[model samples]
Target: MKTPSDSQNNWDSLREKIIGLGDHSLRKTYYPELQQKLDDLQQSEERFRATFNQAAVGIALAGLDGRWLQINRKLCDTVGYTEEELKNLTFQDITHPDDLKVSLEWFHRVLAGEIRNYSIEKRYIHKNGSTVWINLTVSLVSESSGNHKYLIAVIEDITERKRTEEALRDAYNELDKRVAERTAELVKTITALQEEVADRITAEQALQAEMRERMRTMEELRRKDQMLMQQSRQAAMGEMIGNIAHQWRQPLNTIGLYIQGLLVPGECGEFSKEHLEAGVNKAMQVIFHMSQTIDDFRNFFRPDKEMTLFRVDEVVAKTVSLVEGSYRCQQIKVEVKTKGEPLINGYPNEYSQVLLNILINARDAFLEKKIADARVELRVFTEKGKAVVTITDNAGGIPAGILDRIFDPYFTTKGPDKGTGVGLYMSKTIIEKNMNGRLTARNTGNGAEFRIEV
Candidate 1:
């Protein structure tokens, strides 16, 4: 390269020769203007050289075949290579192997007149055998005749920016993994809780079904007990009818005998006023006694409508009176021994029925065993704040096998035709269930004893 001052000396020698060939007047006229134009061109070339060498980013020029013709100072520092060293190698030799194919395609497109310039991010191999990330922009330059001359490439280092973006991506992936694990745990816990709730609901349903079945069974038993009570009442009514017949038999015969004797007196011609008056008086007395007997049986059979206060001893005595006639015919004696006038609150008629049942059962035992002197003794007293009545018989006591079951419904030792088993069962029900009392039976030395307490 020639210095500008040397070029000026050469231009002076060439001007002397041209002045010798041309007119002396023409050289005198154009010499000053020519010198001014040469000075201006030199200044322009110096400005371009200063800007290219001092630029902050890397700048380079390469031939169409990728041979580096020139490299700036910044480009030498960026790739850790001197300008002379880069000149010996093509741009393809410094480019990373992974990025070479795409870079060559862009260069070809420019050569084919498809684009004016292209910019891409790519990796370059540094002189120290390390990778350098960079943003590269390349433009095509042509000669004055419009033929391709060389390429001008500008590059910026972007290694730090790329490293920061990679770090952010890794952090986002870790956070997403933690969130997924927590969500799975919550779903599993919720499923377990739902299953436990279902089990509890099933248990409650089973318990409710069992309770309903028990209530239905209790209702059925209640209806059966009521039916048994009605049967016992009917059986007792039949026994009362028999007693009434026994009581009226002797009175009816006496009245018949009196009326017949009066007829005989008329037939013998001795029908006097005094004799007729005496017969009428005797017949009226018998008829009055018979009427009283009917009233006792009628009252005994009437059901009690409500609770009332009554003495246990008085109820026992009245009950014995109702059955006395029948017992007399059967030759069974009843003795009542009362210690106190113990009062209790209950259905009075039902109490009498209970006593009548025990008395009748005693009579049956006596007849069944054929005891010579059958006797039933009842005692009424107050024991431990309760009214109590006990009836004992001397008919060889109830058998050991059947004593415990005597009060059970439909349990009887008598033949079916002679006995309906509901009598004692209903009697126990009246004392215990209806009156809130207790009825118990046990074998005694002479016979069986039944005790009632309220």
Candidate 2:
């Protein structure tokens, strides 16, 4: 058997090996299993830490007092706070005002162990004064001794989903409102359509009646136009007769005076061959002028059967010469400036008559106004590839507000006896209706301008 000393020696050697013998220790000999277990626990802890930091959803370890112990990267991103910043804040501090009561209630339930965990969709106030919606799931963490230690919170960002839901709700409301409005519009449209169907036949009958009335009115207008045209021609004939008389008055008197002078030379013996020749030549010139005047008057009264191309300047000059004596007698300065020898396909004699009537109206205006420095301007030129003529006169511009009515039929400033008033009415109709042309009038500062575009 073993002695006490041997037993003691065995016990000491075992303790020495287990603890330390010569340079060996108990830790090196016997604590390898515990150390390996501790190393394994530390590695697990490190892995958990890395996983928490790299997690997609927010993860937080908070104290029972609601203070944050640790916050992961996702939690920091969720609250727009840095990890260091979140460590100094509490969950209750960041909770939205409206959600604080519910969030606290759920948290207290978890703390009391009444629930294993609590999940609530709650709002948090971000640092920038914006709200963040999150689905927060919280669980209580306990020590091995069953003492509550910390809370583990997982926050899932649901702000975008909440916004989408809100947008869908708003869209539904707008769609409902639009549907109501469209329904009302459809109802009104159907009512209007029913009324239109009910009155369709009556409307057609009324339309036919209106057409007949229009035809009757058109016939009456045509008759009135014909009557006015006849009256206008008669007035023009009367004026032409007056002009002829004015033209012949001085010449006739001159011829008679010359005949009497022939008697003077025979009686006084002062008349020589030269004087007789001069007298005869002068009389022939006067007679020729008178004959030409009659021819001109006849041609002006004549009508054109078809259109012909004619020089605008020739017609204007001829028209001016027709009334030259009258304008000269009235001392009205008449000017004709033709820059481009404009040509037109039109009735020459009728156009000449139109010019004559306008001149006569101007003369009448000057007579009525008694203007000392009366002027009549006629300008013909090519504008926009069309022949344009403007007739302007210094008669104080048609008396202001009445200028628009001047072209109306039977509208005249002259007294009824002095004007037939159909002259300008006919002038406009011939220029616009007979020929493809336009006539417009406007008041200038010192006169009226009549523009004719052909």
Candidate 3:
């Protein structure tokens, strides 16, 4: 074996001889391949430079100490600073004071290898003394030995987008305010409409009430007109009766005088006592009949008068006296019983009319029944602090079915010509409404009883 240095030299010489043999052939073949690889590397470098320089987002390489080691043109333009000026300052110099701590904390995290990348939107001061809002993305780059070497930061301007967002929010708020205002206006309008509807309903109700009142008034007027017509007929009948009674008055008086003259004694001035008494009694009967006829006429045409306190017995007596002649002819007995002389306050004429109406009804009842021994009883008394007068007749009783409506206007059991049907109704009105008294009627066992309480 040769020495180690001679062996290494022999190997080097072999390598040189091999290299020398291929110098021209290698130049012709491997030189083109080497040139192509170099061109590919240059092209890749150009593509990287073009991509970095033309990016819209600003890119920067910063040292671990936060100094700008390199910056793209976009970053220089975004911060309004030259590359040389930016390299002289640290990232903390341009960061807002309020954002600086948070940004440094994040940077420290990246340096510690705790986070791969971080992003934040923060405000920064530009070279021209204006504020810029930007979104920043930071990534940590380490050496192959795992030492924290540099940080890559991507910055994007977001001031216009933030302002636009704020403007949109303001517009939405304005629209909401306008909608609320319109809703309030609509609510007020609805309230007004409801009020108007209520007012219209009230007015309609009032109108209906007024119309009802007018109808009631018209019906009352019609009733009054009918009453006037009935009264006219009654007046005419009363006038004819008055004339007939007037015509009989003188002849009846003359007959009474003649009879009385006959009762006087001749020459001796004292005749047989029985004969004189008989003649005098006959004369008395004539005078009584004449007197009753005159009273009937008087009562029939009696005028209305103001209210006054009067004895009930007196009113009853007057009513009975007015119809006595007619009753005497019919053989109807009249019985009167009173509890002292009870006084009542009322319109005397109207009260008299009420009594007269009841008496006439009793008379008609007796005639209709045709009872041989018909009788009418008039009783006056006080009950429950009220003056009461009861008129009862022994005759055919009223039918039970028609009794309830007997007091209604235009209701009567008698024939139309014999009874106007208004007598009881008018009597009820006078006693109840005019005199503030009560009048009622009910059928008894044999006949009917009419009661007046004042």
Candidate 4:
């Protein structure tokens, strides 16, 4: 029933009496040291009491059975409960149902000596029916003999901390969602770009393939042209042989008649040495003439190895003369006219062949048509600094439909036996391609006229 002031006064009086005893009689004995030790123990006990009641965080003692035996002021404030009210309830009664099981598990493990201590975040139901989040640290206070004892729990209010952590988690989840959406869009863009590139590559490859095909076709056409040109040369050679036969026919018959007369000269009273020598000389002269004819045809048939300067008129006249025998046999007359000595720089042999091809073509046309009084008029002249030659035939004009294609290789209107079709084509090739001149055909007054200009 004593008041606090009376109790403090009595304690001070007892301490002063003990010190007075130690100073008067126990100063030289161990009693003064014993009194000093007792004073220090009292101070320490006071400090422990103050610290336990006024600690920053909640501190409490609980039974191994999860009962709360002691709780501090901080714990009461955290759970909105009085110390006496909390003491009436076990920690399990206030603990959230979701966290109760784990809390009990930790407590039992510590009680069983499986672990030294444990800390956990848990929730408690406050007296006001609000959620109180807390960090709980628990340890067992055991006897020295290691027997199970009460549990000591230290708790800190962490409601604000948990709220901050939840907010951060939500914001992070939103950021992750945006990143996923952006990444998906980027993937779509890249895929579209890839498809476009693939399409362009395919188109380019097709274009290249088409180009290769066209090149191959051009090369094939070139090879065919070369073959046709070669065939035209062979055909020309055959024509030369026929012309030679025509030219030699008359002289060979004359030689036979002369030799036959030599054996019968005595019967005619002409077997004298003078008559024999004169006859021999006449046969010798015929043989010489035949030899010269052979030489002329041979030289005309020889291909020019290189270009030379020559007269257009001369080439035209020479080419006509070479075929004069065949023309005569065919009853085709050829007349040559020269207005000027037109000069040309070209392959003379090829030029002669061109003229011969045209002349022969004219004769064949006349024979095919059976035209009476057929004639070919050839004129050589110079116009506008260009050498020009015109061979006009009286064998009737070419048909308009086939005239344009006359110079195309392997194109002809005559029967296969009469024409190989490359004659005029090769003639054009010689004048235009070989000699860089022009060879053209058109309808003139009498018939088809072939014009060559260089």
Candidate 5:
């Protein structure tokens, strides 16, 4: 063994001889220069051996057959062996079983010239029977002729590094599990929310459909009510015209007889002023009454534009006169009594029509029942600042069964050809709904009494 001092002195001598050749190499003599170059090569080999013995990393030289030919102090320390003990052992003797196959594969590839060097992490068994992890790098050392030779392997202990990698792997696996669990919970919550939204949409659609159906039903009812009202008014007009014709019959006949009587006095030359005046006066009186009847009908039949102040008694009196001639023809007596002229703000024509409807119903009752000496009494008075009118007939009251429903639309006691059934119904509607008054009927000893309060 050469001491480190002998190697150091040889390297110093080579440096001094190379400096003597100095600036340019071609200026040096040949044989002496060759001798200096050989000396420098020898010194480099000595320095390499010194570094290999003292290196901290393990270094070893092995045969291509996996036998250890040379090993440094660090390699012996890493394997828990002295140089003499490791010298007899092949690398395979201490390599762990699991790492042996891969380690051999790399060695063979290096020998075959397929690879120049290789690095791997492998396990080796120390002499003390403990395991050691190491990073091993094998470099191929071939002959100048490219023939396969020994291999040089450099190794570093890495037990702590391998343990750290195992702990990190466990932590990554746990994190992955927690992420999967959270994702599953989110998916479940989203599904529930979607179902709730779908149910609410269905309910809203059902509600909208129901509302549309109700609107259609209401429109149909309104149209029916309108048609019925127009028909009722037409029926009342026909009845009023018939009464007018009845009133005109006697007056027209009397006027013709008076004209004949005047012709006799004129043609006989018996032109007396008294006879001419009396005959002319009687004819004029009949004409005046007929004109007055037409005027009254005109006022009562005209539609009112808006509410106005009018006397209830006067309205009642005019309404009675309209049917006065008809009542006498049927042998029915009508008496009208009033206390004071009660003024009210309302539709007077419509109010008269309501009274007409009631009186006509009474007259019809008398005719249908063939009641003799039938009479209808009308009373107009004021009660508590409100106008009141009542019409009582002696033609017998309505039957108990349908009396309560008289004011209902399309309810009637008369036959279909005789009445439209909406007469009394429309009367009640005009008084109560249109005029903001009350019209009610109740049975009395004499007949049915209809009361109007405004």
Candidate 6:
């Protein structure tokens, strides 16, 4: 119905309208979908950024040349450095010198793809001039085109763990040192104690040897004393009549004096009771003194058959008293001193013989010296739980040449009638072999002293 130009215009306008409508409809539908996709992508990107920045482990990207390309907040905080500062520094610059070679070797392995990921526990220099220990994990990153881009590293701070390890090591070392010192001290103390024990044992051995030697000497003296005692008994028996006559002369003279006094009673026809009593008493005293002399001679040679605890001081005192009258007849003075209770276990008769022997020897020594001031002193004392009896004569000291022979049988320093030489030998035998004691004689300044320890 229209001409050609009109038809062309209408077709063009229709086609343009259709095209506009189609464009409008497509824009209206596809715009929202595209926008949604864009928003999702943006959210994903934000999430990734936040996760990277807030990661607890340090994250970093570095080149094969050890240049740092990117560093996260955690990396900066771990090294005590700003992100900008870390970016400017190479990983090698912060790496400990000692660990540098090892770290490079690990990096080289990662780049060669010999390992998927590499990890190392290493030390790093911090910005504050301190050191940080880290567990480092490194991985190589590559693009789709197979081009190696950078090295990704994750570093976890292990300073606290390292410090704890060091503390334990130090404590162990300290304890070892203390143990060594204690061991040394204990060894020294044990050694000292052992030495002391050894010394004591040696000393005891020496003392025992000395005691054995003394016992041997005492036995030898006992044999000699027995022989001398036998000889002295024979000699005394032959001279008994002379000794009796010598001892009875004074007592007989006293009895004669007492009888004369009784004959002249004072003013009473009957005999005076006082005079009679005095005369009887005087005669009894003389008889008793004579009887004691005979008893001494008899007991000195008597063999004892029993052991008893006898008071040593009392025995010595009795022997001295018995010999007092004889010593007074010779004008010799005797002295005695007793201390504590000198109780000793022995045969009383044998001990009495020992005392008598010593007293006779002392009296003879005094008579031989005949020094104007003749004194014999007998002292008894207790020392360290043992009784010590000492007989000292103020007569001339014994001659050194004869001192050792004094206890030998038949070895006399005086005339046969005056000295039998058996007295000291017998005394030593009784005091030691019989009594389980010690006897020693030494010359003093004035004369000789004999000490008996029981």
Collision count for each candidate, in order:
0, 2, 0, 0, 0, 0
Off by over 4 Å in 1: 1-201, 261-278
Model 4 TM-score, all chains together? 0.53
Write candidate 4's Cα lDDT for 174-230 as tens digits.
989999999999899999989988998998899889889988988997787677767
Worst 10 residues of 6 by lDDT: 1-10
Q: 353-444, model 2: which lDDT tens digit per residue?
A: 78888889888889888999999999999999888888999888776688777779998877878887788888888889888898888889
Which ranges in model 2 have alpha carbons more than 4 Å from their true place? 1-213, 270-277
Question: What would you estimate as the lDDT of candidate 4?
Answer: 0.84
Residue 90, model 4: Cα distance from true site in angstroms: 54
Superposed by TM-score, candidate 5 places the C-alpha of residue 438 at a distance from the truth, in angstroms, of 2.1
TM-score of 1: 0.57
Using all chains and alpha carbons, the TM-scores for the candidates as numbered come to 0.57, 0.53, 0.52, 0.53, 0.54, 0.52
| Range of the 10 consecutive residues with the lowest summed lDDT in candidate 5 | 22-31
Q: Which candidate is the best by lDDT?
A: 1
- What are the per-residue Cα lDDT tens digits for candidate 1 across 1-454? 2233355578667656765755645654666565445456558657867988999989888888998887889999999999999999998999999999999999999999899899999999999999998999999887668788788999888878877877888888878887888878888888888888888889888888988888888888888887887788888988888888888887899999999989988999999999999999999999999998888888887888889999888888888988888899999888999997999899988999999988988888888889999899999889999999999999998888888898889999999876889999999888888999999998889888899999
Q: Report the lDDT tens digits of candidate 3 across residue range 126-189.
A: 9997888899999987767887767889999998998898899999999999999999999999
User: Residue 118 in candidate 3 has what lDDT?
Assistant: 99
Candidate 5: segments with Cα more than 4 A from true spot: 1-218, 272-278
Candidate 3 stretches with Cα past 4 Å from truth are: 1-202, 205-209, 212-216, 219-305
lDDT of 5 by residue, 63-142 (tens): 77787777899888898989888878899899999899998898788877788999999999999998889999999877
Segments in model 4 whose C-alpha atoms lie over 4 Å from true places: 1-219
Which residue pairs clash in candidate 1? none
- Model 4 steric clash total: 0
Clashing pairs in 3: none
